[model samples]
Target: MKKLIIVFGIIALTLVSCKNGDENNADKKTAVRKKVPVRKEPKNVSYTLESAKEWLKKNKSKQNLKISLAVNRTDKENFAKMDSVIIPTDLSGDIVFYLPFPLQVDFLQNVDKIILFSYPTQAFAVYENGILIRTGPTNMGKAKDPTPTGLFFTNWKAEETTSTFNDEWELKWNFNIENKKGVGFHQYELPGYPASHSCMRLQEKDAKFLYEWADQWVLADDENVKFKGTPVVVFGSYDFDAPKPWLQLIKNPKALAIPESEIKEIIMPYLSTILKEQEKRKKT
Candidate 1:
């Protein structure tokens, strides 16, 4: 009986040892296999103008632009070629894309109003966020008599305007809609800044269209008279003739969203013309 019990215990010990060895070997095999691979980032992504909505979804801030303003400057072509050499290189300055007359830009999310400015022109182009959908060209002042460039707040303007000094037919430069302070933008004949009595003009159709563009929907509160929110954008270059204190703030401003090189490139082409004009003065 004692021999039989001892043999049974020996058999159980042998089986347990063999089972443990088999489990250990399986664990080692699984641990030696390769790990899953990681994916890489995409190189570039292309987008279209039609994707404006999709653009806002991805790029919510001004810092993140989905599309760039395609500027083809023909006006300054004889003056300089800045488009090729200026951008994509100097990433730190305000880049002014040269646009033809009536250039259109995308109004991003929450952008209800667009303030437009043209060099030597007195009138400002104002467009509603969504309703108008296009920029309505307005008048500046008159021929030789131009709108002064500088920091300003547009609360209201005056009335009685003409598109042409020769033509009798004229509409409200400030739309004659309401709250006109006797000096506002409206449709007057376009020949030059000397065409008006200090009031900026626009195409009657453009002025009428813009007056109702974002009316009531926009905050008419004036800004940058002494504060900022007034995005004073000038499309043309100025002579070192130097601007008023307010105008100085706009051109040589300290606050900027782009690179210094870009700022240099932007004005460099235009200023070269001024510099040339000045050099001639020195020679004289």
Candidate 2:
């Protein structure tokens, strides 16, 4: 009987020890969860047409005069109805947009000449050795036939060219980027939207300037063209269904300017290639 009693006592003690250990483990787990920090997202800023107009009017003199350029491109007749469109914010919480607002041009410098086009902003900028010499608005390919994104060298140019798709369409100051598909930049209509047929449509003056400024691909005596011309980087996407992003400038003028760090990130991918092309150009 005494032996039986002692065995029961040992089993009971073992059970009690295991229960205490389990409780200690649970407490540790809870403590660890409490110590973990929670990540908080940025606060969303909202806007309305009346609010944007009011903001624009109040700070007219304090900001850059061209800050309103993006919104100005929008159809004023129907702009007020687009008040619900949200202004985008970047990873750093700064307003992210592209308009003719002076581009923060400190990122790229190696190339002799470069053309950077942003779809979101519908804007193109020309740079020489890192300085932003000129910027203008553009109407890119429509949603059905979007302009291709990535690095491309200028292929050839013409003072005037007939559209490959429709001979009736005439393109003035046509600078071809993709010759095979009839894709190029030329002076065309801009209804403040992406309405092109897979080509970039620039203002007449801008198209003329680029035609005269950018070098065309070199051709050998046999007439085979080499990939030797100015580098053009067409990046970013445009949301056609949404109102123009610059309309948000009425809410925050600074939103039209992207942070330079973001610009650096965009150009970093192409820096090595740009350097190689710069070297090749120098030799030629």
User: For each candidate, C-alpha RMSD in Å?
Assistant: 34.0, 26.1
Which prediction has the highest lDDT against the true structure? 2
Model 1, range 66-113, lDDT digits (tens) per residue? 112221111122113221211121222222211122222222112234
Residue-level lDDT of model 2, residues 45-163, one tens digit each, is: 33334344444445444222232323334332222333332322322222123344233344454456888888887878887755566667777888888888877788656686555
Residue 254 of candidate 1: its Cα lDDT?
Answer: 26
Off by over 4 Å in 2: 1-71, 74-104, 221-227
Candidate 2 local lDDT, residue 150: 78
**Could you estimate the TM-score for every candidate?**
0.32, 0.65
Error of 1 at 235 (Å): 5.3
The CA lDDT at 22 in model 1 is 16
What local lDDT does model 1 show for residue 49?
A: 23
Worst 10 residues of 1 by lDDT: 13-22
Instruction: Specify the poorest-scoring 10-residue window by lDDT in model 2.
Output: 13-22
